[model samples]
Target: MLPPGKIPPEKLREIVFNRLGAPGERVIIKSDLGVDATAIDFGSSVLVASTDPITGTEERIGFYAVHINANDVATFGAKPKWFLVSILLPENADEALLAKIMDELHESAKKLGVAIVGGHTEVTPGLHRPIVVGTMLGEVSEEKLVTSNGAKPGDAIILTKWAGLEGTSIIANEREEELVKVFGREFVERAKSFISMISVVEDALTANEAGVDAMHDPTEGGITNGLHEMADSAKLGLKVYAEKIPIREETLKICEFYGLNPLALISSGALIIAAPKENADDIISALEGKGINASVIGEFLEDKDSKVIVENGRERPLERPESDELWKIV
Candidate 1:
């Protein structure tokens, strides 16, 4: 067998889908393009459930766990109502650290109006610092469910926030000592605030209100990966201008220091909204009115291959979430 990191993308796809199985009875696989979350249909309402572990990074794992799953559910235009969290602290972890994590988790969840329900936890020798996993439960009306596959040929794609926000943040926080010595202390300090912008709760709600056809948060992969997945899910193409892509100052610094493509990293808080051309302005207005920075990145096209138009009038196929550069830095 191949090493864990060297596993083929297709094989990993099989592992995930095989575990997902086929949708039956009360569960509907509903747009399983390795999108953020899964939904279960019960009666007239659809309940979205998504869980993710936060063992891989050090900075604000508790905060990330709360927003990440809720972002998944909110992508469907659903309001997050409940969250179940599991925090497994290492035996030797300090009580202050544990308290800080729990406090951050509760504060964020409460702000989002998501009640902490039920989960399990234990201290074990196998653990390192602490692992926090959260599952968010949200429900949407039957008529308004927007799948990642809902983007149409003529839909305009609007990207919110900067690209590679999460990946850059992780690298900055985790490699602070090295980055400070190499790239100066000011540059290193600037890279860490990317976490403050780590929630799509506003983006999702505003987009839905402004008549967005479909919405997705750019998480595991960056903006390009998200657009590719959306286009493929809808069996369409994306015509985007890479020059217009938003990149944060901190993100640019991190990408430059790490020799990475800013567009191919992780961005948990960014949202991509696909809407009709007429409602594009409305959506942008709604987003900007709420003080959320967004831009008209591109539009969906009829062409089969998803492409991003770049510098000097060149174009290339968009990046999908095959092997993210996030792993390289994080």
Candidate 2:
């Protein structure tokens, strides 16, 4: 069986996506690997939709449920407006736990200016913890719609914020006691606060306005797999500079302690933008001006087979992560 992360891109294309039914003209963007959201034409505007499930950690699960799905829609240069979630409660769950989850959902959605229209909630047997699956709907103008496949050769690949943001928070929250012993309470608490950085809506919209060709939020497979997804979707290659990739101090310490690669951990707060080399700096500045850290990690190459990571003069093929490094500890 596949491990607990995103399905491999190849199998997803062959077994799952290949079976998608044909859509009429209303479908602007159909299901595709690496693509974040699908779009349907609605005359004046395009309705963008994305769905994601939150099952990794129980702490802040409600907040994660909304942000993860909304982040995908935002990557399409859309503003998330409506949300629907499926809440599955574990057996023997109490009313207080359910109330807490509902309150979190409401607070999270309200913060993002999204409405929780409707959803189904049920108590299931043989479950250990609660799971929230969210579907987000957003809207974008026709000209502003961006897809993952829009990246072109010679485009500079820019990463906003730092990698492993989500994984660090999850680890700190889920294994606080274990981490506190090794890294002290202060460090663990700082790492746990990274959950506040999970939303990339502003980063995505800023890059879109700055003439970015493609935008993606690295989720399950982290930055390494995120780059692979962009390259795969665009049918291009990437030459990433390992030293150029942004890694936060807290993230580095946490991953080192856990013996996990920070680059291959789930990172929802980071935004990947591919743009023309000439416009890359402006895009970076735009994001940084908003208190978001941005860096040029690499460039898209002409050769489709060339996915290289240059680090300290050494070269290596940037392989797609089979599963998120978070799974190792979680």
Candidate 3:
């Protein structure tokens, strides 16, 4: 049987992506492991679309559904304008639960200046909690379009925000009773607030304007998996500095308590940018100027096989994470 998290890349290629029946002529980008969103040629502009399901935690599922999907469209240097959602509730759910979710969705969409176009909602059997699957749509001029495969060798890799941002918040909310006993209610609340940082729309747009060859929203498999995906998509190698990767104190504490690797945890708030070495500093500055923390954690290498992370002056191969570390706990 397959694992509970995402299907392995090799299996995805062989079973899912490769099985897409016929390719459309106007399809600018097809489904792939590292690609964030799909682009289709539409007259003078490119239409970008991405969909994601929120299943890890129900704490802020509605809010998460909007931002997470929007982040993907933003990664392609597109402005998300319309949203569609499919809400599946458990048989035990009530009207209040649906109302709470819809309220959150409305507020989140309003904050992002996106309109809720249409969607479907149903009470699904055998489900224990609610699941919101969101699809975000946007358009971008051809010149402004960006994709994960655009990263070039020798380009600098810039990271926005910190790692395990989403996982930290999820753990705090899902296991609040257990964590509060160990670290007080205040700390848990602070950790839970990490959800507010889950949107990377600003980070991507800012980096794109500052000049970036590629951008990716680190989602299910965290920073490490995201890096691997980018490299794979671009067919390039990379050398990352372990010390350069940022991690918040809350994420560190929560991961340590569960003996989880923060680097392999789900990281939605962070963005991965590939930019020319000359533009890396400008990109970082632009992001920081917008109050978003960013750093040059690595650079692409010429040899496609040379993927490694330097730690304490020692180099070790950077292996792709089989699954998100958050799964081990939550």
Best by lDDT: 3
- CA lDDT, every prediction? 0.79, 0.92, 0.94
Between candidates 1 and 2, the TM-score winner: 2
Q: Using alpha carbons, what is the TM-score of model 2?
A: 0.98
The clash count of every prediction, one per candidate, is 0, 0, 0
Q: Which stretches of candidate 3 lie over 4 Å from their true place?
A: none
lDDT of 2 by residue, 1-330 (tens): 877788888789789987877656799887777987899999999999999999888887899999999999999999999999999999989998889989999999999999999899999998899999999999999999999789999999999989999999999998999889998999998999989999999999988998989999999889998999999889999999989998989899888887899999999999999999999989988988999999999999999999999989999998888899989987
- The candidates, ranked best first by TM-score, are 3, 2, 1
Per-residue alpha-carbon lDDT of candidate 3 for residues 1-330, written as tens digits (9 for 90 to 100): 888788899998889987888888999998987987899999899999999899888887999999999999999999999999999999999999999999999999999999999999999999999999999999999999999788999999999999999999999988999999999999999999989999999999999999999999888889999999999988999999999999999889988999998999999999999999999889989999999999999999989899999999999999988899988887
Structure candidate 3, residue pairs in collision:
none
TM-score for each model: 0.90, 0.98, 0.98
Worst 10 residues of 3 by lDDT: 321-330
Report the Cα lDDT for residue 37, model 1. 72
Model 1 agreement with the true structure over 1-330: per-residue lDDT tens digits? 653122344665677556855556776545366356767888889888787777558568888989888898899888899999888888888878878888888898998999989887667687767889899999988676767677888888898888887887789889999988888888877777778787898899888988977888876557777787777667788888877889987778777877888887888879888999899988988999999988898899888564656565887666564556667766
